[model samples]
Each structure stands twice: as C-alpha cells, then as structure tokens.
Target: MTTLYLLGSAAPPVLDIASVIERAQARGYDVCLGLTPSAARWLEPGAAGLERLTGHPVRSGYKAPGARDVWPPADVVLFAPATFNSVNSWALGLTSSFVVGFAAEAIGKGIPLVAMPCVNSAYARHRAFGRSVAELREMGVTVLYGPGGFEPNLPGERRPGGFPWELALDAVDALAP
Candidate 1:
C-alpha cells in the first residue's frame, strides 16, 4: 500500500481529521498522521486514539537528531486545511514545524505532494497567501485552490461547505511522476 503523510495545521477542519484518516484508508492508503504544533495541542486529548486509528504515533515536533524516522517514507503527502501561517512558512522554507518542514523538504526529495488551504477570504486577500500558493505550485505541488478546489469563506462566518478532503485526495491520486 502507498504510504500517505496526511498533515494538518491548526484549523477547524483538523477537528474532523479522524474521519479524513478513515476516508484515506478506504482509498487504499497507509495513512500516517502529522500535525502542526498548535493543532497537536488542540487534539492532544484524542492523540492516542488517533495514533490507534492510523497505527502510527501522531508527530508534531521533530524527532531527536540522528534518531530513526518513526514513520515510513511518504510516497505522497496531503497537507490539508493548511492555515495562512503554515502556507507562508512552508513557501518561505521555514522548517520550524515538523509538518511544514516535511513538506518543504519533500519538494527537493521528489515526493508527490498535494495541498489545500482552508483560509478565510480576509486572510486569503493577503499578498503572501497568493504568492505562497503560486510558489508551492511552481515547486510541482498539486495545490487545490480556487473554484475547483477550496474557496475561502469570509472571516467569522462558517463555511457551509466543509473542507474539501475528497478533492484533495483526488489531487493526491492524480499526482504525476
């Protein structure tokens, strides 16, 4: 089975990540879960359950230097509900967080990558957001954004449509060699 690193940032969608993991598994992926620090904290209480669900420990911070990697090498990475901060940090090559760091390095390692942002419109309007999206696309990451992908909602308003995990998974499946 293909090993998929399903990474998440701090977003409302992260709350439903268990379902996403199940969906990915249903699609025949060996799912490994990674989360940004804040997201990890938010989901701390359920961490063990999530680990059980994925059959891998949930990783938020980097492992000790020179230590073996706990998870298998990712055949592909699906970073969903990437926040504005995560997107910008990743584009700029900031590896302060494990999830973003893995994604940034995945580009040069030639791993297939897919990303879908879950920003509010107000945040998306920032100049950096567009640049970050373009940068990731330029690096050959399949970014699901705009009409056919995720459309940002207005600030403080709930998006009636939930995060588009299916669309992201489709993009991941379609990733080119």
Candidate 2:
C-alpha cells in the first residue's frame, strides 16, 4: 500500500481534505493527515471528519508518551495548500509542529516530497518564496504550482483539470519504481 502523508497549511484554498482523501482512496492509496496549528483553524470541525473519511487518525502536534507511534514511514509526502509560513519553516528545517516535523523527518529519510504551494500571488511571487522553492527543488522535492493567476475558494473551483490530484498520484507513482 502507498502510505500518503497529507500535510495541510493555513492558506485560503485549504485544498478540501475530503476531496483529496476521496481521490487518494479512488487511486488505492492509504492516507494519513498532519496539520499545522494554523491549518487546523482553517480545517474547522476538527480533523475528525477526515479521519472518518480516510479511516486513519489525523495527527497534529508531537507524539505523546506511548502514543503507539501510528505513523508508518510514508511512501510519499504531499503538502497541499502549502502556506508561505510552512514553506519558510520547512526550508529552514524548523520542526515546531507535527506537520513540519513529519516533513523534516521525511526529507532526512530520503522520502519523496511534493509540495503544492497555495499562497496568494504576492507571497507566491516574493523573492524569498522563490528561493525556498529553489532550495526545496535542489533537495529533490517536487514543488507543484497551481494555476498561475486565479484564486479559487471552493474545492471544485481550485481543482480544475485535476492537476492537484494528478501531481500527488504522479509523485507516488514515480516513487513506486
């Protein structure tokens, strides 16, 4: 089974975890979600809905004492709706939260990482963001960019042509070899 680590951020699109979970399930992959604190705020109703949808717990924060260590080494890590904050943090090796920690660990273990940045045009075009994207690419992470212009709020609005799902599954498929 392909173990997918879904990392979320506080960006506006949010990537609609439910849609991502559905697509991943349809593609025959098991998924676990990890959320940043700010991302949690945007996720709303808690990640319980996601857990129910994917049949796996949504992990946030550090693992507790004897918490059973549920995270298996992931086959592929996809950070959808990756925020500017998360991009910056991950680039700097900051593991202050569960999402960032998992990303850091995955990178160290040579796991394939794909990030779909979801910042606004201003942030996306910023020099620092460009540098961070370059650094991540140099480290062999696949950085996926959404449509260059429009900012869509809803899942359907944002998912035109299914590039997000394609990028995610493509990353997993590439790692399969």
Candidate 3:
C-alpha cells in the first residue's frame, strides 16, 4: 500500500480532516494523520474516532526518548489547510512542531510533498506569503495555491467547507509514479 502522511494545521478546514482520510483510504492509501499542536487540540473531540479510522494514533508530538517509531516513513505527504504560520515556518526551516519538522526534512529526503494553504485574502497579500510559496516550490515541494488550487478566502468568513482538498489529492496523484 502507498503510505501517505496527511498533515493538518489549525484552520477551519481542520474539522473536515476525516474526509481527507476517508478519501485517501478509498484511493488505496495507507494514511496516517498528523496535526499541528493547535490542530490536535481542536481535534480532541474526535481524536479517538480518527485513530479508529486510521488504525493509528493521531500523532502531534515526537515519541519518547529512544522509543520505537510506530508510524512508517511516509511515501508522500499532503499538508491540508496549511496555516499562514505553518507555511512560513516550513519555508524558513522551523521544526517547532512535528508537522513542520516533517515538511522540512521531507525536502531533503526527496519525499514528494503537497501543501494547501488556507488563509484569508488579507493574509495572502503579505509579501512573505508569496515568497514562502515560491521558496517551497523551488524546493520541489508542490505548494498548491493560486488559480486552480486554494484561493484566499474573504476576511471574517467562516467558510469551513470551501477548502479544495481534491486539489491536494490530485497533486499527490500527479506526483506519483
């Protein structure tokens, strides 16, 4: 089976991560879910359900010292509803969380990566945002954004279901050999 790590950030779309997991499974992906620290807290209500769905713990932090790694190394990684903070942090090589850490290392490991950033139009206009997207793309990470990917949402909008998750999955399919 193709092992995929689905990394989620703290955003409105995080609530719908189960669908991503379900979709990947339908596509024959052995999916493991990883959440940013804040995302994990938001997902607390359904944490057990998520674990049951994937048959693995929804990991947010590193394992105990010298402890065995439970999850397998990812064949590909998809970061959905990636926050503005996580995008910039990943570009700047910040491993403050397990999700970002995996992103940083994945680049060097040559593991295929796809990212979908969820930000409002105001935040998307920031100079660093474009630069970070460019930087990630230059690293060969498919940072899904712009016209066909994730478009910036209007400010103050609670548009939870608007995230284009299929684009992320399509990126994965396109990248796969």
Candidate 4:
C-alpha cells in the first residue's frame, strides 16, 4: 500500500480538501491526514469520519501525547490548500507542530513533497513568499500554483483554485517502480 500524507491548512475551503482526498483515494492510494490547528475548526463534521473514509488516523498537533507517535514516514506528502503562513514556516525549516514535524522529516528522508498553494493574490504575490517557494523548489519540493481566472473569497467561500489532484497523484505514481 502506498502511504500518502495529506497536509491541510487552517480554514481551507471544504470543497478543496474533500475533492482532493476523494480523487486520491479513487486512484487506489492509502491516505492519512495531518491538520493545522485552524484546519481542525473546519473539520468538525468529525475527524473520525475522515479517518473512516481513508482508513487511517487523522492527526493534528505534536504535544497531544499519544498523537505524536501516529505519524509514519510516507511515500508521498501533499499539502492541499497550503496557507501562506504554513508555506513560509515550512520554508524556514520550522517544525513546531506535528504537521510541520512530519513534513520536515519526510523531506529529510527524500520523500516526494507537493503543495497546492491556496492564498489570495496579495499573499501569493509577496516577494518573500515567492522566494520561499523558490527555496522549497530548490530542495525538490513541487509547488503548484492555483489555476488562474477565479478569485477566492477572503471572509468565506474560499474557492478551490487549481485542481491539483492530478499533479499530486502523479507524484505518487512516479514513486511506484
């Protein structure tokens, strides 16, 4: 079974995550989730439900005692709806939380890492953000920009920008020898 780690940002649009996971599973991959603190607020339909759907535990935070051990090295790591904050943090090599920790460890092991950046135009256009993304790319991380033409809402209705599911799955497929 191919192990896939799904990393999500805080308050990601519901449609974005649901569609990404559904598409990945459809391609016959085992999926696990690591959510940011803010992401947990939007996942209240129940993390257990997500786990049931993927048949693996959905985890968040590092200091959750037993939860820290749930993270396993994965074949592929994908961050769907990646926030500007998390992107910067990851770029700076910060592993303050379980999500970040797992990402850092995965990258260290040369695991394939992909991210679907979901941010407004201002954040996406920031010089620092661009530099950080470039740095991650230099480290072999694949960062997919959101598809153009659709404006995302600020307060709510965070539109699912690009359909990054295909790109994510392709990364996994490359690992299958």
Candidate 5:
C-alpha cells in the first residue's frame, strides 16, 4: 500500500482529522499521522483513538537519534491545516518542529509533498506568507492556497465550511506511486 505521511498543524480542521484519515484510507493509502506540538496537544484526548485508526504512533517530537523509525517510509506527504508558523518555518528552512523539520528534509529526499494552509485573512496578508507559499512551490511542493485551495477568512472569523482535505488528498494521489 502507498504510505501517506499525513501531517497537520494547529488549526481547527485538525480537530476532526480522524475523518480525514479515514478518507485517505478509503482512497487506498496507509496513512501515518504527524502533528505540530500544539496540534498534538489539541488532539491529546483523542490520541489513542487516532493511533488506533492509523495503526502507527502519532509523532509530534523527534525520536531519539539512531532510533529505528516506527512508521514506514513515505510514498507521499500531505500537510493540511498548515498554520502560518509552519508555512513560514518550512519555507525559511527552520526545522524546530518535527513536522516542519521532516518536511524540509523531504524536499531534499525527492519526496512528493503537498501543503494547504489554514490561516486567517490577517495572517495571509502578511508579506511573509505569500513569499513562503512561493518558496514552497519553488521547492516542488504542491501548495493549496488562494483560489483553488484554502482561502483565508477574517481574523476571529470561523469559516462555515470544513477544510479542504480532499484537495490535499487529490494532490497526494497524483503524486503517490
């Protein structure tokens, strides 16, 4: 089965990521879930259920150096609900967080990567965000943003619709072997 490294960041969509996982599984992927630290915290109460769902450890932090990897090597990586911090950090090559760190390295390893940001309009307006999105694209990452992907809402405004996990998954499907 194709292994999808489905990564998430601290965003509301992440709250309901289990359904997304199920969707990916239905599409014939062996999904492995990774989260930003805050995202891991937000989903802590349901961590066990998520682990059971994926049949892999939900990793937010790095394993010990030289530790055997628990999850299988990725055939594709899809990062949805990527927060502003994660987007900027990844584009800037800052790998403080394991999710961003792994994504950064994935680029060099020739992994097919897709990302979708879930940020408010305020954050999207930042100069850094646009630049970061461009940078990721330059790195060969299929970033779902703007018209065809995630549209930012006003600050403090919750969009009525769910995050577009399907779009990310579709992009992954295109890239996955």
Candidate 6:
C-alpha cells in the first residue's frame, strides 16, 4: 500500500482527523499522522486513539537525534488545513515543529505534497501568507487554493460545511510521478 503522511496543523478540522484517516484508508493508502506542536497539545487526549487508528504513533516532535524513524517512508504528503503560521514557518525553514520539519524535508526529497489552508480572508491578506503560498507552489508543493480549489472564508464566517480533503488527495494522485 502507498504510504501517505497526513500532516495537520492546529486548524479547526484537526479535531476531526480520525475521519481523514478513515477517508485515506478507504482510498487504499496507509495513513500516518504528524501534528504540529500546538496541534499535538490540542489532540493530547486522543493520542492513543490516533495511534490505534493509524497503527503508527502521531509524531509531534523529533525523536532523539539518533533515534530510528518508525513510520514508513512517505509516498506522498497531505497537509490539510495548513495554517498561516505553519505555512510561513515552513517556507522560512523554521522546523522547530515536527510537521514543519517533515514538510520542509519532504519538499526537498521531491515527495508530492498537497496542502489545504483554512485561513480566513483577513489573515490571507497578510503579505507573508502570499509569499509563503507562492514559495510552497514554486517548490512544487501542490497547494489547493485559488480558483478551482480551496477558498478562504471571510473573517467571522463559519467555515464551509466540509473541509476539502478530497481535493488534497486528488492533488497527491495528480502530482505523484
């Protein structure tokens, strides 16, 4: 089975990651979850559940410098609900968090990466956000945004009914070489 690293930031839908894993499995991918530090804190109570669901530990921090990587090599990556801070940090090579480090390395490794940001329009206006998105796209990461992809919600507006995980998955398939 193909291995997909589903890296999530602390966006709203990180709480529903179980569904994302189920969706990935249904599509025949072996799922592994990697969460940013804040995201891990938000999911602390459910760590065991996540481990059971993926049959692999949810990586939130780097292991000891020489520790073995337990998860399978990633065939592709899905960065769903990628957040403003994480995207910017990732573009800047700030890998203090596991998810950012994984994303940065994956890009360099030529692993197909697909991201869906859950930013409101107000935050999307930040200059750094645009630069980061452009940088990620330039690096060959398939960012599902703009026309025909994920749209930013307006500030104070409830998020759309469903986050677009399918788009991320399809982008991964399309980008796989």
* TM-score top scorer: 5
Tens digits of per-residue lDDT, candidate 1, 1-177, equal 999999999999999999999998998899999999999999999999999999999999999999999999899999997999999999999999999999999999999999999999999999999999999999988889899999998898887877888899888878733
- Identify the runs in model 3 with alpha carbons over 4 angstroms from their true place: 158-161
Error of 3 at 64 (Å): 2.9
Best by lDDT: 5
Give lDDT tens digits, candidate 3, residues 72-168: 8799999988999999999999899999998899899999999999999999999999999999999999988998889897898865667888889
Error of 2 at 98 (Å): 1.3
* TM-score of model 5 (CA atoms): 0.98
After superposing candidate 2, which stretches have Cα over 4 Å from the reference? 146-163
> Which has the higher lDDT value, candidate number 3 or candidate number 4?
3
Candidate 2 Cα RMSD after full superposition onto the native fold (Å): 3.8
TM-score of 3: 0.96
- C-alpha lDDT of residue 135 in model 6: 95
lDDT of 5 by residue, 39-142 (tens): 99999999999999999999999999999999999999998889999999999999999999999999999999999999999899999999999999999999
Looking at model 6, residue 146 earns an lDDT score of 81
List model 4 lDDT by residue over 25-44, tens digit each. Answer: 88776778888877876886
Worst 10 residues of 2 by lDDT: 149-158
What lDDT does each candidate get? 0.93, 0.74, 0.91, 0.71, 0.94, 0.88
TM-score comparison, 2 vs 5, better candidate = 5
Better of 1 and 2 by TM-score: 1
lDDT pick, better of 1 and 6: 1
Q: After superposition, how far is residue 169 of candidate 2 from its true place, in Å?
A: 3.1
Q: Give the TM-score of candidate 4.
A: 0.81
